[model samples]
Target: MKGKGKKLRKREKAMESGSVEDVLRIDVQNLIVSLNQDNDGVAEGENAAPELETENLPEPGTEIDVKVVELSSTGDGLALHEGSKRVYVVPFSIPGDTVKVKIFRHVLDESYSIADFISVVTPSELRDDSRIGCKYFGKCSGCQFQMMDYSEQLKHKKRIVEKAFRHFSQLPPELIPAIQDTIGSPLQYGYRTKLTPHFDGPPSWRKNREPFTSRPPIGFMLKGTHQTLDIEDCPIGTDVVRLGMKNERARMEVEYGNYTRGATILLRESTRRIPKNESRPSSSPKARSKSPSPLPPDNAAVKVETESYTDVKTCVTSNTATSTEYVGPYVFYNPAGSFFQNNNSILPVFTDYVRQHILPPPSSPSSSPSSSQPIKYLVDAYSGSGLFTITLSSLFSGGSVGIDISDASIKYATENAAANDLPLSRVRFIAADAKDLFTPAIRRAYPGDQTAVVIDPPRKGCDQDFLSQLLRFAPRRVVYVSCNVHTQARDIGVLVRGLEGEGSKGTRYSIESIRGFDFFPQTGHVEGVAVLNRVDE
Candidate 1:
């Protein structure tokens, strides 16, 4: 009995690892084991395990017509071939689409094959090709849903969130709340604040290493390949950045020979606030010259002015140069090359959602009735340059502290705090390892009952040690923001289970809500936010 319990626990842990392939593998193995157990009393010849039918598998380079019946979490279309009893993963094909695809590779062990999309014979009702904003939508790897309706895209994203939690959390369906519809970006196109375009130099194997007779592609990578497609303009980039791309490409025309290796050029959008009275017309060269960084000839500049202030937009080329952006009334300055949310239009909405959900845990009847302390302290882990710390400082009466492993990020957070005129007594920035973030000093300063933590980790999600430390800290509430929902689901599962055997005296957490924000609208990417509250049993 104990051995069976250990095996079940291992199975639960396997579910938490979070991948469609992993889940399928486990399911197949479990089925085989169950079949064997059922036939234990029967002769081996009576019910032998069926051999996998590999003879019917499709060959590479073969063309087949398939009707896409479902959309995978990765934004690809899934079609099952009846003849081969195999699933086909076709890119650039939407659910309900009748597509002609060329078989590229087979995953015979999994009974699925990968195919390259040829053409859509019949478009799905959800697809509106006319609505696709970019001409490079089909070839460019940057976007997956440009042909999909905006409303449909949001719906699909919500499904992605739901599927992530279902596949990875390993929790009962009753325990998880219904996921909310994905929040859409205000400006679908012309919203991305940064664009990186690159061009390759002559290959090393070439004997001559001669300069190219013609200019090479200076844009994003092509779909399924590392080679870049020459893109004169990208609709997703802000107008200023698009113009900057053209200007930089022209500059590279003359200087392309100066490099022996390929290089990526950074085009980050910077916004400056100028008093309306002092602002000049954006088209004027003088207005463009106001930038601290030297301007290229015919530099693009855009200005939007209100009664009190004018905001000018320009592209910053230097990675180390300071770039500025405005979220609401608040201002943020980070290194141009450093990581910042590329989608600016949706940040205000995203931050507001976080603010609204950070406090006042739901009342539980079973726990003895006692008035819960109002959450007065905020802890922003993986805080980058004070985006969340400063934006949320006003809500916490006791104080807010931002912690980051990067010392440079901490320095800028402090500077941003000062820049925003936030009272020093009300806010602080700490440079510390996230795993050791909740030290004795922090625990004493901000008690768990009155503190809320907001962790916005990278795409890889939080480390196990850091998550264990977080469980030990046990804040009243936790708002986890992640670019990758798969990782988020795995980490949340760990927190929900409370690190049972990980040498931590942590309690379980109840999930309050889960949702996705459409940070990158045309793409498969969705930013997931999961709110968890301590379960006071």
Candidate 2:
């Protein structure tokens, strides 16, 4: 019986470890069968449609017909059509333009399509003939609006933001501004503070994946394909960040026997200096030997397990040669196997916008020195690493509080507060769920003190409990920071309606302001900030 059970378990494990090709083959076969059933007894002339061709694939300049459906947040139309299975096209076409598009490359499952707008079948009055500025405009996916006029881009972004708010929040239109603008980037180029280069070769090409034989050559993955485009230059990253990646790639080729598969490389740069000995150990003894004496135990770099598609091995490279960092005051990050804002240049502007909108105006007489009132407090809910909380601590002299569900975030926020020289007594870090902590903690901390709540919720937005708690507390101001405007709107709807079964006293807050920031410029994602004030009446 035990032997039989072991055999069955082994069989199940084998089925679970199927390769990508195996899965694709099954899907293709099923699709082919479905097509055959859909068109039974078709004539040979009609059935002899060009065999799906993979050999001598179209070059970079080839054009094909594409149909677009959805417009990416960057205003690029995402094309979807039948017959051309697993294909998506982003053309210079507007929402309704159906024209010939050139296929850039066949990616893993879909084709990356771009258009040659020689003629518009159905032209809209909104379409303009403006030329883009950036030299690497067409190839680089960083800025989709490069070809679009600034004013048009703003209009498109505003429409997208407003639509999301209306569709998701269902709030009155008058409550929010159509759009909010921060000081635009003076010099768009060389603004990014961090850059990460990906390799498509063997293990030897990476510090952690060293000691392997020849594999595919190394480079960054092309925007639309699984194939890597050998990148010699990046227009956006700082010289030091770019140089560091270049040096690391060269060193990998020399140090390892050959580029091996399943290895990743990490390159990070920050304005905050990594003190001597805080750097990770180097793969090369020569590199390690040159560094200062061993780091103190307290300052040792913490070993955190990073999740990757494959087992990740890391090596550190520091460019001590660069005296001054990038041109702006920004936080640069290249997190391994995760999503992060790539445009580090505009981060300060984005952060400052949120801070200014959430914090009360300095000129308010209620907060002035002549008044003998206690300063109001702010709650930074879902505070990740305490970035917003620590930065805005100066607004509340009596201190403020931040709560997050993530244990790592709580620990980081605590350390960050101490690092920023904020009085620990004034700043309380609670490692608890935001929904559970807000109402009870506020009630316990101050029975009647008016507070302001700045919530930067996750993409899905707040839960029922969270909305309930916020409504219960009825903070003087609720600054909602959201990545998804739809959910933000839905949550706001619940908050605006207030508790059920209660007469007259229901609607607790009134929407005062709504605005959005284009944090992720090239993508369809948007970040919205909404301010709601408790209605005393």
Candidate 3:
């Protein structure tokens, strides 16, 4: 392949550590393959036949050595099988991990496989537990990074955010601003306010595991299996939760055979409210704790409630989490198990980032009595539980509108605004179809130089109709919030290539910045926010 009379030398530099760009691609197959190649033992498709017959495929449940080269968005590791014709995913694995795994695949599909970890052959250098490690590190399915150093985990998460944006945007990395460092939780391990510990009926009660015992054991489901790991304490759970479960476990032994099948216990920790100004924009502002005193061990409660949907029984347990908890000055009615952000530690930082971009500081008006109308309106298109609009309504001088496709969400918003004591004159909430969420009154109220729209859609990202309407409305600024960076980048791409008035020009909004908030720590999840500014023709 070398073609040169002068013999040009190839120069290669070692890739910087943890650069996702060098190893990941947008295409799923390519991404899996590249990550698989990063491992040492998983030699890529050496000298194998082009296609293996059904009878020739590797036997299911056979243990083999595989190296995890990349972590999936959901925290699984991507690896490869022999001949490299198919890829396998192993959970509870980090990149650079060489582990023995038992392989299994769907009967009809030989193109993919799933692996269960037998033992770790070589642990990744990123793993750290120098001070102390959790005994449930491998057995429990709760926390993924108990072995990883906290700082290293932060670095990897930032890299994950950057990688996702680039891959989904399908653009050069230079276009997007460098992702900020992951904001860590003040309480890394014991920050969780709620826990759902479960137990399965023994073989005696269920007749599944040969002779069953009828004792209800409490804890998390085992990694890669339906089995539950009995736990007396979980580090990730709050002290309040631990004490609640501890008592419940003792009670379970006394009242044995109460559960005929599988059952779960819900433990919730009651928390105090904090005063609000919690603003973190480009800067990583320190989030203040609500209570100067420590969390009381006895400030916890347990209750059981059952809700059925889609022919499945779901149990939810909630504590006295309330609407008075302030994120900035806004009071959100956070009913237990309703979608208040999980990590209380970084919530102020997260909300402030959203507010800063959505409501920029007021600037001096244009000189010479400019004819251009200055934007005074703010619209929260996807106002879930009214977090954005209520918190920001007072910031906008003219007025604000909050719209939601779900009537329940709008109702919650109304209740929250009233609880926050925000006047009806200052802001209003509307329930309408997302396609027609923005009303003409919005244009009338805030018709000018800098109107802002804040949107936080479900994990799938904003719908196209909403996006198109956003373009037509052409707000001066748009702040898009998403937990899924890939979908966010997809939406960003569409926004970047938006059409101008009557298709007269290209690109209407300039991407101002892309930032990540570490809303969830010790997990794969993160909240990403992007700010886009409309360009005047």
Candidate 4:
């Protein structure tokens, strides 16, 4: 326990410093390890330099040619240097592509350097620039893998999950299973249901109170810079949200002088159920002529008709306004400003996989022999608006519970369960801290031996306290869903390496599978899900 505590503390200290380069070093090292796994000499590129004079590292702004050997977890290209001790990270470059780059920053302590992509001297077979969808592909910070082929993108994400465990999960290699192929999204582009485009006020405009001669840039931040790029339309956003962006930009132009400071404008797509026979009110000529509509008349107000009802989608700008999204037959409503999955196209596949793996596979009518006791209950941790609980309640014979620290989220989760027509008696929501998850009453109500827990934590991942409680609970199975694979790996590592050698009688967990879902296509972002089964000694 002392050794494990020290290791976790060291990692937490580094994380608290908030240095992106420190995290990148771990990913870069893992990338090099994966590349050379087969001893195939993947690092021996033609342009790779041998152990360089550490003192003679390339000066900042120096131009050099290098062949990319792999891509880091951050979606930057990695090239071997100084015999893999020192590495060069080039943005917007792919492996097997020889590119010219300008050295920008050197992380001497970590033995890696950051470079700006200049031009490709030779392209990788997997590199297809023609596949790029966005006009601001290289310069925009919003996306990283737009220039890459979609199939290759999925493969790279799989590699990212493998590297994540290798680097952050401090477990024996044999304890981990082979990483699964990444699930691809249905829509490669135009899948995002929300977009928050913002613009900064002109410097000192508040004091000057002057009108600008030109329109300010209203878009996302530029890559590697603090400035914003004037993006008129984003291809990644849904059609309704994109139209909202256009309308919002127009409003910003006229109201730029009124703002005291820069602000983010929310454009969240919301859906409402209308009668199948009803005509779209927002699309009517009379409604368009009205002086004030809930949304701009030009903004998309689309009507999708089905046999039972019609779904009308529109973009919501107010933070307090309700935003609706659907995953299969389940509907979810959250504040427009609140966090929800941005890509609706991938929810069906993602949720289905989660449901299938919630418990041990059914080998027979009951449970597998290895898992003698079948899991009949579920606990969805950090469940916002009952995304997992409502969707997964049908599988558990003993019903499910959704828990969150936020009372507002718990309230919404309860309401969402009722709205989805799920039996309130079977589905419940609780607002409580993770540290006090398994109270005496709760333990009696839902026995851990028959319960499966699903955890979907934020990007920072679970803290040590939460992990410790989870280990003590010793549930039948744990399905960890995370956006930040690094933190997920760290947390899972702690759980897998429980206090066995120490004084306590610790329960052990085995990694069943690791898979990534392509929630955001044409981007480096990946959503990872890891399944763990409690081991019987």
Tens-digit lDDT string for candidate 4 (260-360): 56778899998765445654432221222344335334336766678966667889999988787778878787888888899999998899999999978
For model 3, which pairs clash? 203-212, 204-212, 373-449, 374-449, 375-448, 375-449, 375-450
Candidate 3, residues 1-537: lDDT per residue as tens digits? 223211211110111112222222232355544445665456454222223224455678888888776676656677655555455677667778887888766333333467777777888887554523468766777666666677766777787777776656645566777777766777777666567788877656555433325565578888877888988887776555566677777878877654566666766554343223322111011223222433223234332222410111111254333322445444455555456565655677777667676754457233323224565778887787788887778668888888877777788788777777677888888888888865676656665355788888777776666766677677777888887776777777667656434322333566778767766666767677888776665
For all candidates in order, the CA lDDT equals 0.79, 0.53, 0.63, 0.79
Model 1 alpha-carbon miss at residue 440, Å: 1.7
lDDT of 2 by residue, 346-383 (tens): 66776777677665455643532322244367788887
Report the candidate with higher TM-score, 1 versus 3.
1
Candidate 1's TM-score: 0.87
Q: Where in model 4 is the C-alpha error above 4 Å?
A: 1-23, 30-53, 80-86, 205-214, 275-298, 305-309, 364-371, 500-505
Error of 1 at 499 (Å): 2.8
Error of 3 at 305 (Å): 32
Residues 129-182 of candidate 1: C-alpha lDDT, one tens digit per residue: 898888888888788888888888899899889877876776778888999889
Two-way TM-score contest, 1 vs 2, winner = 1
| Candidate 2 vs 4: which has more lDDT | 4
What TM-score should be assigned to candidate 3?
Answer: 0.73
TM-scores, one per candidate: 0.87, 0.62, 0.73, 0.87
All-Cα superposition RMSD per candidate: 5.7, 14.2, 11.5, 5.4
